[model samples]
Target: MTDEGELIAGRYRLLSRIGRGGMGVVWHARDERLDREVAVKELLLDTGDSAQAAEQAMRRATREGRVAARLRHPHAIMVHDVVEHAGKPCLIMEFLPSKSLATVLAERGPLPAGEVARIGEQVASALAAAHAEGIVHRDVKPGNVLLADDGTAKIADFGISRAVGEATVTGAGLIAGTPAYLSPEVAAGGEASPASDVFSLGATLYAAVEGAPPFGDDENPIALLRRVASGELVAPRRAGPLTDVLLRLLAGEAGERPTMVRAREALTAVSEGRPVELPPPRRPTLLSPAPRVRRRTVVVGIGTAALLIAGVLIGVLISSPGEPSAEGDQPPVIGSTSERPDSGCVARYAVTNSWPGGYQGEVIVRNDGEERLTGWVVRWKLPAGHTVDEVWNGSLSRAGSTVTVRSADWNSVVRVGDSVSFGFLGAVEAGEGAVPELVCLPD
Candidate 1:
């Protein structure tokens, strides 16, 4: 029987159980050979199954070790070694004095927007690096995010993370992630992708700020799965500037969501209270400085090219002049300011997402002028009868027909050639959703 003070692998002495999850039990232990503290995870296996099944489980555990050991990031827990003890695989990892985000939320309730964004930024950075290595963190949740004693946040438990094309360790037809944070596609029997990880990250951050999961914390797992599979996520109430980032991350279609890298940038921008500018496209060679839009333009576009390279086709259209598309697949680019060589700043507006009676809009304020701005306000007239419902990443005010968005305190300064952005959801009448022009003033 396994008990405290028992020695494993002839060098590690088991102390006490520090954590328990679906996969295994994590014990705080001492590495007698190295004279250091470490975490030992005793992998649980089904022994009653056939010998072949047992062997496959063992192989899977070994493969997990190999896969996790390849990742080396400051925010990711390090896997030191893997060994077999009592006919099961045990993972030895770096031990840190920390509390899981799950425990923190349970004890502190909802976290502040800035604090949650900081946490999300760090965790997303690790996940982004992991994805670049072709590893997918299939189970990303609050329980897997660790808050270290030195105020650093690290992502733990990559045991369930799968490399591309690997067979699932779980039994046939079984899902691998927590229902509350599972992406809609995964909840509906689809494969987990980096996009799914973005969804799970969004759900984790959503829970951190809203005091509950996006789909609510239902008691029954099956019922929760049903709700998640339906893909109707509840809107966040307390997100404030964090709301738009969460919305983009929690997009229903996996392809609609941003990449983990872009998610990390967005979270970082929000945490700093600046306009959110997505990182530039990866393949600069495939894009033209001025490309004409048609019925279907197939070229390298922001947020679209990376997903294409990953084998997922996304319909992010940039419409030509005039009315928005009736399909409403992607909000059309309404208008932009004329570019001047040394202009201080310029504003461009696009309808990001739209529906029957509402739409989401984004404004990119780019610094093109010689002087840096300590503060800024962008103003434009909303179409007659249209009203702004909410805004994120900036403060909103109105004077009759004119709508003004001022930079937030944390994001007020504009550097040369850099950009900041804000998004808003608005109520609008059909055919009257277009804005005439935007004027930017730097303070």
Candidate 2:
């Protein structure tokens, strides 16, 4: 309600209203005492809420500003002070002549991969720095990203951010971030982690390259929230080179999302004109095609009538599971025993479920090699006491005591130091046996 030229806290004079968002309005203002330009953000308070709740909300906002002040990154906006104006808290921050990423996208549509990556590198680095100090910018979206004239991309608006242990300002069941950018976990009422921020950044960059959020732009907030909570991401067609990294950051599993540090490195690689080596898409099935399949079979063409039947039957049996081969589906072939020392892939299996009659298992295969891996087949004995009943993510076959699980089309390639996970459900004789050892074969 304050008019232009009005002074707040007896120091800063309001010049004009520059921006308004759901939570607050930003003003082009002047620091009368320091004789400098500044931006003042007026925090909106709920008059209907009890006086106690309102007071708590004001303190929380001031505390968030103080936390943001601790950060001094080139890509992070600087928070100067917190003061009272119109009987409410107004946070004073640095004023920059720039446009929000949202406005830019509205005017220019999607950005180029290189430009998006450059912007992402700066913003991701800023996030990593803030995370290092135990702060989270709960709200990270195009609207909060500022593109300065000097080409600096800065992350603004920590109004809803809370220190790791602090309570949320949105109260129970209320999310603090834009629904379009919220991670699935947060949409499902899960706590926000560094990974959460990475998810948001992924969504933000996704919008940068695709011209809209991964989830469709539905006018209904609840519908959009449902889409985010569903964790079904629309792939980026125009992202081009940025497609891989953006998907990695938007992985459905929080643990699967790339770390901000790793994200920053990948983005930097793109910005520097180097190739970005990202791990597989968050959901492997969506992007990767199934590995090329090979099935070797034979049939007897001619022989004595009875002999022909026996020979043809042999072929069928030989090609079937539980038959032994000279080197039946062996581990990746090693040229020499000495070459084994150079193998860097590792596989681990865990029994996630079990019953007296059967159990379920999951295996993760990882590449620790210095170079990227192409395709792999993992071998493990089904254990003398167990029999595989069903499998997912792979083609499974048994030859005598050994079981081979070939990578599905999608998981054939493994990123350096990253991994692929697959699983199976199988029967157990006495429900007791030591797990089997796993060996990965290169394609």
Candidate 3:
């Protein structure tokens, strides 16, 4: 454990221990350079490791640092730096002054559907971004998610994430992720993928609504892994349609599970109080008989260019002419606008961090526009192929292809600079894609 006044990397002044995990201790610190609060994770080295293990550990740390640095998303915890502390690896990350989902649920009970959906969307978005970059977050569980003071959900701890095509540095005997959220493939030592992350998201969502993990008990890790491998976990009906989505995600066969995009759509429907229909199963082509190829017949013909010109002239006369243009000309109007006083108000939104599982983020709606806004609505377009899974902080309604979030009575009023924040969960399409569009409205 680090002393209260101890400083790491000569830049971060440790304030106090915020958390402790199997790998190390997490301290809340002040970044003297950025003048912002940050979290520093310090790992303590075990004395018995041989030279080979030490080299492997260093390699793993280097790989993790690279992966974490490459991942950039609103839901992902930003890594500021990685350095050696006490001869072991330590990572500096964005400091979140809020509690984890597990602690919040323990104290506040089950969260509402809207909150769950919003959190799920943000985490899924983050995962999509990481997966697009070929990084698989090996660990996705409730404890990894932090609900920030600004009501944003940020995923933390990339210590075990593996970049695609990279050599596996963690030993074979050790399990990398929490047993309760592990996919069957992961339990069997198979490579993790975006699909695996979706499975973990399902488990995390199940726990969020049910107030406990699907397969958790007082039993040991081995027993939990056995249950997960056997596919004997129960769905959390209390989570509503979220349970159905989880069932699909937790399917023993990865091919049978819905893609993150599809899952997000289902959850979005649930959040909007609409019925969700599962997509048709993709048929296996190999199981069907192959079609016979057919030979094409060739035709020999001759045409006269002079005759074609006459036919074209006759066709043009038979077609209707274009519509007439309008007669009047209108003048453009310009007006001076003043910013609302409530523009400075901060809107708060929350994302529940469940690493490797889901992506979530929150948007704060401030009355920056020149208006006393009430009963406001916000609309935004996700990336073309991306989809929203859940939403919270108000009534979320979707029209056509756009998502519209409206403030409820308790959250509706925003006077001159007053702000209100809302959150959403989405499954970002994994690949090299542009960031989704964001827009807001008042009144």
Among these predicted structures, which one has the highest TM-score? 2
The digit string of per-residue lDDT tens for model 3 on 98-187 reads: 888877877887787667877777777777777778777767778777787676887777634331112121232222234567675454
How many clashes in each candidate?
Answer: 3, 3, 25
**RMSD in Å for candidate 2, one decimal?**
18.8
For each candidate, give its TM-score against the true structure. 0.60, 0.62, 0.58
Candidate 1 wrongly placed segments (more than 4 Å): 159-177, 278-443
Better of 1 and 3 by lDDT: 1
Clashing pairs in 2: 290-409, 291-409, 332-441
Alpha-carbon RMSD of each model: 17.2, 18.8, 22.9
- Candidate 2 lDDT over 1-443, as tens digits, reads 45899888999999999998656788999998999999988876654457765566567667777888898988988999887766677889999889999989888988999999999999999999999998888778898999987889999976353321122223322223346787765654334678889999999998888887777566544445446655677667888888788888888767677788999999999788888777865463243222222211111112211111000111111011232333211222212111233555666555543334655556566676787778777777766678885555567888887888888776778989877766665677764556466666566
Q: What is the lDDT of residue 366 in candidate 1?
A: 71
Error of 2 at 249 (Å): 0.7
What is the per-residue lDDT of model 1 for residues 226-339, given as tens digits with 9 covering 90 to 100?
Answer: 466556666678889898888788876665688998999999999999997753322111111122121111122232211111112122322223535433113445544433
By lDDT, the candidates rank as 1, 2, 3
Where model 2 places Cα greater than 4 Å from the true spot, the runs are 159-177, 282-443
